[model samples]
Target: MGLLSKSRKASGDVIYNNEVKPQLVAKDGNIHIVMINSFSKLVNQNFGVESKYTEQIGSVINDLQQDGYEIVDIKFDSLKGQGITGTAEGFHTLIMYK
Candidate 1:
């Protein structure tokens, strides 16, 4: 065990990280898409000005930064229906990493 080993995340952290982070990789390189919506909810939905996943998104960003990913830019979009699912209460966050 070394300095890096000491920084290793606990199993809970791993599980949470996996849940918050999308399985898709960056369209080009280190960029990633983060979806914050009711479908990702642990129980219910968040319809306030702030998102329920805001804090979780921050954690994911921190973890990505620790992995040598520099956040280049972030863009957000209000996501709507995909196919015929109808409107959704979620946001699409595009994160570019260097």
Candidate 2:
């Protein structure tokens, strides 16, 4: 890879290590974790539940699966002003267990 591209990849790695990876870790009991991912766009005039879900959280979920983590359940919510996404509309909660 070019020097600039390598630097960009390194920075992205740092970001994933610092941010995205932590969101998938267990909050308690070392068994399961609950993660919230937000979407700002809609698909096919609907929540685009599974597709959007797979698009946003797919890779991380795949990694977890390789490490023996399995998805227990997934839930969705449509809110206008709540949680970390004050005005965000589409959101999904992923529940995973090892």
The prediction achieving the highest TM-score against the true structure is: 2
Once fitted onto the true fold, the runs of candidate 2 whose alpha carbons sit more than 4 angstroms away are 1-17, 23-30, 42-51, 80-88
Give the clash count for each candidate.
Answer: 0, 0
Model 1 CA deviation exceeding 4 Å by range: 1-51, 80-88
Cα deviation at 13, candidate 1, in Å, is: 5.0
What's each prediction's TM-score? 0.47, 0.49
Best lDDT goes to which candidate? 2
Question: lDDT for every model?
Answer: 0.51, 0.53
Q: lDDT of model 2 at residue 1?
A: 48
